[model samples]
Target: MYNQAMVIGKFYPPHAGHAHLVTTAAAQSGKVAVLVLGSRFESITVEERVKWLAAEFDDVDGVEIIGMRNDCPEDYHSDEIWKAQTELMRLALKSHGVTSIDAVFSSEEYGDRLAAVFGAEHVLVDPSRSAYPISGTLCREDLGASWPHIIAPARQEMATRIVVVGSESTGTTTLTKALTEHYRPRFPGIADVPEYGRQFTYEKFDTLRSVVPDAGIQDMVWTAEDFSVIGARQNEMENAAADVCPLVIADTDSLATTLWERYYLGEGSYGSYHAADVLPRRDLYLLTDHEGVAFEDDGWREGEHRRAEMTEWFKEALTAEGHSWILVTGDHDRRLKTAIETIDLIVAQRSGFTSPPWASRSSVARPALEGAAA
Candidate 1:
């Protein structure tokens, strides 16, 4: 057992393989400092990487995850470049009062040299990739294919969220359900979050009926507080779905709630808009057009006459917010096809990541630096 051990990586997005390496180091050493090195060129920020890993290992004993910026160029053959990079690592550890590493844990070829620099013993773990058959490169190349390998926080962050919005009975629920079904075969855990606003409406109407015995949805008044509750619940459900699934199809989201509050309360409402302001990042907004689709009352909808006007409001709001959205028009089949194609394009585009400067060289053999390069 070593007194102190060190693990270094780029952890561009810490995956299962990276977790395995850190746990192995923690098991063998009294304490392990996992240094996440980031460069200006990478898309995944160093602070985000640190947060994800820290959350992943929060319950584990004596494992410290830290992040530092290392802009030094990658060169396996240059001693000067190695020295520059190693100094950043030393400073990151020293800030936490960690000194004199007894072991250096890595799955890369640089383990020997990194250990020598620290005057620690080199301990290699899963150099063959037999333990977890995944890498950051594979994850970057195809997020959908490598979805299962990514850690929970990264999975939530990378998950593609498609929010279906529009006027009442505009097939928002129908489309969200269809999209969820469409992706479930490839992404087994894919699921759609039902419209929480509708549920809130049902409860409100139910409560009203109990008091008057003849009260209808029309009789129930909508307050700013009601929309606030709906907005908060909508965001909660969407985030919970994203935590476990690669793709989340939300029937409606907090942003949609903001518009609904404006529609009902004559605009300038702060309750639901405040909820929308803090919502997690949403990928796409799909507006189900009310032009061709007939609105069905379903005993709960009171906005059939306002369908066209509401649709226009949604389009305007989405445009003003600079959110990516598409109007789904035509019959159900055509609409489904258009939505699928658009989403496929988004997934493909997200998967194609810009390689860090260190990975641009093909001659340099790729080693598992956890998520970094040595």
Candidate 2:
């Protein structure tokens, strides 16, 4: 086993090719050092990418992530980037008491990159299929297409990534992991949309409630606040796909937010919506009934019959908002199968696309380089 390995990349957005490098390194090296290239511009911040990768690879013991800031300006072109980066690796190796074990892994400019840092013995890896070289750039371009079929097959090699959000434990997390297994997909990029209710047990919940007219915060938490989070979250997920579909199969999303509005407020409170104000919208949205899954409160969820009201309200809400969504019932097994198929259907649409589909504008598009590109 390679005791120590180094992975270097800008990861402007970590796509499938990026995952292949890390997945291979984790398998080959006893420990992998990921030196992320830093940026001088104010666009996507370093902290955001670091956090996303951390969440994605939290379970891998072999991976050690580090960020290398680019202090030099764009005009300051020097072959020295290769030199300085290599020296950093050599120092890391020496400190670890590692003479050398396996090799350096990378996607872009692998020859000069590994040679500059590790030596001539650096092995070149083509993680993508021999014929098709899937790189970050390719994933970025394809994402705008929102093609699920081509994406689904490409992601088969990488670990499964899922974001579960909905009322109580409607198997959001359970189903995410289960699908990950049933699929045996690469999962270095999986993350659970933290039960936002729990995330703000003290802070955000209290803060929102203080201003919220209804103390029925428990019922509406998934909606009002979560919508803001979900939209922001999906935008981030766009950049993180690789070794996983750019698809973000949400457990619950704006549809639920609308239901929360209808349930807590009057029938007229729910309003029109769209995500990112773009076409070729979210791949899939799975809304579950409380019937299949029993509601258990860890002090987060509050409702007597969360079964039909929320589900019904959501159907109306989704239709009014003009988003393509499916309501899922039955036990976990049946619902899981539906979700899988639904995602497949969405992916298939991406394969054969004419013109981009029209989508309602949810909000203004923020500059991608602003804060988070995860």
Candidate 3:
């Protein structure tokens, strides 16, 4: 039995396989030290990867997570390269007050060389990867295919949230559902977060009123505190959904709540809703235009006349925040097509993959939306 053992890896997003390797090492040693080497060019940041590791091993005793930002040598077989890399590893361990290592655990052939350098025993764990059957390369190539191997909560940053925001009866919910269905096959864990503000106003409050005649519920009379609660609840729901999926289709977000608070409760009254720090910025926003679309009176809609004005308010709010958004107009089919094409472009840009067929005819160029003013 080893007193101190160490494991090293890039842990690019740290999937279940990596977890198994670390946990196995911890079981054989009194204490297991993990070194997470990260590159500047990787999709996930070094800091974010470290947080995932800490969270994953929070309950496991004798597990220490350390992170380093360093790229691997260009020539792996060069003697000088190996010597320099080995020295760096020694320094990293020493910095953590771990001067002596009894064993080095790994799943790669390099485990032998690394252990030799420390004059420690080399312990290989699942070298063939038949046990966990996953790799960072597989995850980078296609996250959806490797979803089963990922830890759900650690995927929050991996999620691309596309929020549908607009005035009342502008088909935000319809478009949200359409987008969720369209991307379901490509992203199995895709989710749809329904509008929480509407649920609060139409459902929750109605229930309260039924229980008490004068439930202190005045129609269209909401305080800043009320809007704050709505904003907080909306954000909470979005986060919960994001934790489970790689892509979240939100019918509305706190940005919409900010607009509603300003429009109904007055401009400065929405001060409580300006706490954008707590809100998650969406990757894309599909602002449904009100032109040529007949307003269907949802029980909560203020009036048809306010639809255009409310749409403008949403645009101004989004523009003020420098959010990436595209104005989606026309009939249901056209609107859905535009949204899908835009989302495809976003996914392609993020993953460095080929765009879908609809992306070829995408309306707004990528630069224009990305460079929009705050």
Candidate 4:
């Protein structure tokens, strides 16, 4: 057993393999130090990688997490390059009050050279990767497929944000719930963001009615400031949901609220909301059409007369903002199928991994509009 052992990696969204290497080293040594090394060009930030690693080993004793910005050459075969990188790692360890290393643990052949540079024994774990059978390159290529191998939930590298938006009585809420249920079985980390605008409106119902008699329901006397607050809250809720899941289904986003503000309060009112800038960018938007759906007045609805018009407004607004959206026009079951298909495609594209067998089933096809903004 060694007194001090060290393991270093880019941890480009640390997965289970990285965890195994670190834990193995910790078990063999009195003190195990983990060094997260990355550059600005990497997909995920070094801070995020450190956070993920630290969170994973928080309860473990004698484990230290150290972060470093690496600026060395990418080619590891060069002897000069290896020596230079090892020197930098030595300096970093010394700065952290770690003077000497008894062992250097790694999953790569470079461990031998690195350890030799430090005059330490090389402890290689799973050099063939047969046990973990995963890599950072594989994870980056297809996040959905590599999701199960990811040790930390917070490090969902390619989390897909899907927003369900449409006019009132268009089954946005119902579809959102169904979609969440559908994906949860395959991706257990799936989550959904509730309609924050409706929540805010309902929570402040009595107060608004007291101020204005016609304030009950969606007829409340709201201003641009009120919409701004709602948009901000909605964004906050969406981000909270995204943190825990690889796929987040939002009932509605700030962009939908901006459309509502423009529809009721006119175009000038929406400029103040800044929905595009404030709201988190969604991977896909499912626009529910109000053509066949009967507009049921839930007291908050703007009546059945303007349902089609409002639906068109949503499409126009989404298009103007250069959002990737698909128009779903069908019954409840058909709408659900379309949503599932669209989301599966997005998951595949973003993660470079194919959808599961069940999610691969074909559904009603629709042409997706892409990049329409000015």
Candidate number achieving the greatest TM-score relative to the actual structure: 3
In angstroms, how far off is 297's CA in candidate 4?
0.3
lDDT of 2 by residue, 1-374 (tens): 77677777655445445666787889877888776655655233456555556666778897877666644332114567556656655664556565664567754345444655455346566633332244443333444322221233233322222333355556666776565555445323343343332443556667777788576545344344444454444444443343244434434444454444455555654231343343123444565655768777667556646655655665665567675666667888897898788666554454322211221111212332111223
lDDT over C-alpha atoms for residue 120 of model 4: 93
TM-score, predicted candidate 3 vs. hidden true structure: 0.81
For residues 1-374, could you state the per-residue lDDT of candidate 4 as single tens digits? Answer: 89999999988768878999999998999998898887765656678788878888998888998888876765565778767777778877888999889999998777887888778999989876766767776666546556666775444334689999988898899999999998888777676689887877776787877788675575567788878887888887787776666688999888888887787688788643775576665798999988888878776666578778888888888888898899988899999999888888887666553322221111211111011100
Task: Give per-residue CA lDDT, model 1, range 190-259, as digits (tens).
Answer: 7669999887887888888889998766678889999989999988898889876778889989988988
lDDT of each: 0.84, 0.51, 0.77, 0.77
After superposing candidate 1, which stretches have Cα over 4 Å from the reference? 1-4, 23-32, 39-47, 54-100, 123-134, 266-269, 354-374
Name the lDDT of candidate 2. Answer: 0.51
- Look at candidate 3 and tell me the lDDT of residue 2: 82
lDDT of 3: 0.77
Give the range of the ten consecutive residues with the poorest summed lDDT in model 2.
355-364
Ranking by lDDT: 1, 3, 4, 2
Whole-model lDDT, model 4: 0.77
Per-residue lDDT of model 3, residues 191-266, tens digit only: 6689888777876577767877676534445778877888888888888877766678899888788888887777
TM-score of each: 0.79, 0.41, 0.81, 0.62
Which of the two, 1 or 2, has more lDDT?
1
Q: What is the RMSD, in Å, between candidate 2 and the native fold over all Cα? A: 16.2
State the weakest 10-residue window (summed lDDT) of model 3. Answer: 355-364
Tell me the lDDT of candidate 1.
0.84
